[model samples]
Target: MPSAASSEAPSEASTAPWDVHRLPRADGKTFLVTGGNAGIGYFVAEQLAGTGATVVLGSRDADKADAAATSIRSRVPDARVRHIRLDLADLASLKASAEALRSDRLDAVVHNAGVKFDQPDRRETGDGHEAMFGINHLGHFALTHWLAPLLAAAPEGRVVTTGSFAATSERLDLDDLESTRDYRPDRTYGRSKLAQMLFGFELDRRLRTGGSTVRSVVTHPGGALDSLTPPRPPLHAPTTGERLRGLPAGILVQGKEAAAWPAVRAVLDPSVTGGQLWAPRIFGLRGPPGSGPSAVIWRTRRSRPACGRRAAT
Candidate 1:
């Protein structure tokens, strides 16, 4: 429901006329998107609000979160959008937000908060997990778990986790999850994404097996350019990878576009079964939304995201 122009940026491939724009409003559905202030998260919040769904922009930064909600309301004059503070790195804040939400049932939740290799120093959150694992995976894991009861109250709820193709290079090191002894920024970020993907897969498997009606889906926005994403070829190395060699790093897709395609598909696409992975159809994963491959990274023996698979109740 964001302004049609908000997501109108061109993509790496031919752009679609955003049928999402025409979809009817989601009158009764209520959604919460973490990191919903900037980048893809903001776009997701805006679009959902455009559908007339009550959107809660869960954000870590108080100011940014407020600004995002304000912008969404501005874009959609009647949008019933609001903001909530949720520092994923801190469980206390996540819990407080869960308790404060007035809605008893959440129609869907999009876990999109993440950080890449910007900071080289190893970081540990309040919960003591590696900064990447803590914020990107476990923080979300705990938040979702705390809200599962509310989500389950809905007849057909869904959970969407944003992952990245960068995860392909990741392998979880449970023993070194905190990265206390060694710090490799890029690899750590990859590990965080890997955790998210596995958590999605694991969440799906458990949900299906438990016969829970609530659906869980995962998405990987591959090759999309964003602030969190490394520069093409990564400044650390200039001439690597086919996608990185020449593509105008910024031309891949706008954060809004990259997020819109996948977020819309994940929440509204009828065929989007639980556990499905959605990405762009074109080279950048920046085009029309379509199912994409779940990387083999989560399948490897080293993945330690099993903890995320645990069921509530």
Candidate 2:
């Protein structure tokens, strides 16, 4: 167990009142961030801990999660953060992770863990579902179901599912949810993300119908690259092509810290309501976070060019 501590003292060099450096205080709150060991997830945990939230990092790798917690403590000296092993690719692991949550009342959960397909070969989980859909959708489905009770008990609870713009172009095939017959790596990933967004929208509807206070929303960390993210354990130093790609993209893409803003807002901001989609301000890419149309909105609005044609609306 990691030692508990109060929030870190704010910095004196703060620029704007609404800057990521100056979030509204979250003292005494408790939240969980899945895939909290790396990329956007790591920064989300760090930011939440800075505001006085007890952050539980749900990760498949215990050592990596511990390292992330240590890094947060190093940056925010008094930050309260801990790690619990959680493998989202496996259903049994999700159940165990939910059961092991130490907090009696969880204020929020940020579902951020996922695979960025870099290979052409298809993969599947032990349960025989496609790896991307299994981890990104079904795994989270079970985890959220298990934790919904705890969330409902809190005065205000939230579930933030991280989605992608790719979802807008991909249609989910209920008849072939696993993408078994035809699996193109990138398209399958898009389908999985779309499924996640669908789940978020559906969850909000169900919560509203059931008169539950637990809100569900979706967010996308646009153009967040591994090159801009801080190093994690077992670092595979960027390849030559990746380094070349990073140099040009660094100008256009937001760093992991900046990309984390939308997710952070989804988890903590009071103004953000259920079923909203928060995204980056510039080109939905690199800038401060802001509210965007939800997937439900995209489904309904055909006037928008990007959403004019729909295979899965």
Candidate 3:
């Protein structure tokens, strides 16, 4: 059992503001971070490990997942970390993957893994849904359903969905949800992420209505550029020139390490309630985690139900 100091939510008015650098002790808690093999997910996992919690990295690639776990253990010598095979693209396999999770109780699950294609070509998941929408939205949705029992068993379980800033300017096209009619790489990706944001909020609404204990929170990693991020050995080793080049952009954007702050805060911050949006403080671009405005598209009643129905189908 976690100590009272670790599990209880700190008083917002009495306690000092939450600090990303110094997280509360989570000795007996367990957290799962999807896409923990690289980018923002890796940093989220690493930071969570520092809190004495058991962190599980969920990825499709077994080797990459192992490498990420190794990198984390190297940094935090006694870090209790492991990897799980979680291919979000394959809907049928998510149940097995959820079952394979060793922990009996899950304190939190960070839905961070997503797919984005640079080329104009539109891809589809093995389940026949649009690649970005399927993996980014449906995968996490299904996984949450399967993991609900474990989450409910915890003292205070949380589900943190990592959305994208791009979603702020986009709206889901219910008429063509899969982008089979008019698909532009960037627009489709943005719409897919929007669907995810809506799901996070809707999930919380339903959870509260059902009188469930689990909380669902939404977050976005401002503008996180790889060039600005620090090196993590085999996982990521940006050259000095790259870091220097990214220095100028540092004023507006930040490294992936910093971007991971919002998700980490959403997961561990006891004060953070379900259905709230957390993002970087500076123009939703870079800085510490704080409450941010959610897109009007996600707030609409029609869109939320449509998103849930589409993902269900």
lDDT of 1 at 135: 91
**What ordering of candidates by lDDT runs from best to worst?**
3, 2, 1
Deviation (Å) of 123 in candidate 2: 1.0
Sorted by TM-score (best first), the order is 3, 2, 1
lDDT of each: 0.72, 0.79, 0.85
Worst 10 residues of 1 by lDDT: 1-10
Best by TM-score: 3
Instruction: Show how many residue pairs clash in every candidate, following the order shown.
Output: 2, 0, 0
Q: List the lowest-lDDT window of 10 residues for candidate 2.
A: 1-10
Please, what is the TM-score per model?
Answer: 0.80, 0.84, 0.90
Which of 1 and 2 is the better model by lDDT?
2
Residue 166 of model 3, lDDT score:
82
Query: What does candidate 1 score on TM?
Result: 0.80
Per-residue lDDT of 1-313 in model 3, one digit per residue for the tens? 1011121122233323888889998999999999999999999999999999999999989999999999999998799999889999999999998888876899999999998998988889888998998999999999999999999999889999988868756666666788887889898898888888888888999999999989998888889999999899999998999989989999999999999998999988887888877877776788888773463344222233544664421
Query: Candidate 1's error at 123, in angstroms?
Result: 1.3
Model 1 agreement with the true structure over 1-313: per-residue lDDT tens digits? 0011112222323323346557556888899988888777777787788888899888767777777777777678799888788888887677788886787899899998887757777878877777888899888999998889898998888999998877766656665665666578888887788778788878888988999988888876555444423222211122346335445645565444455668766887656788767777665346667663443435333333457763322
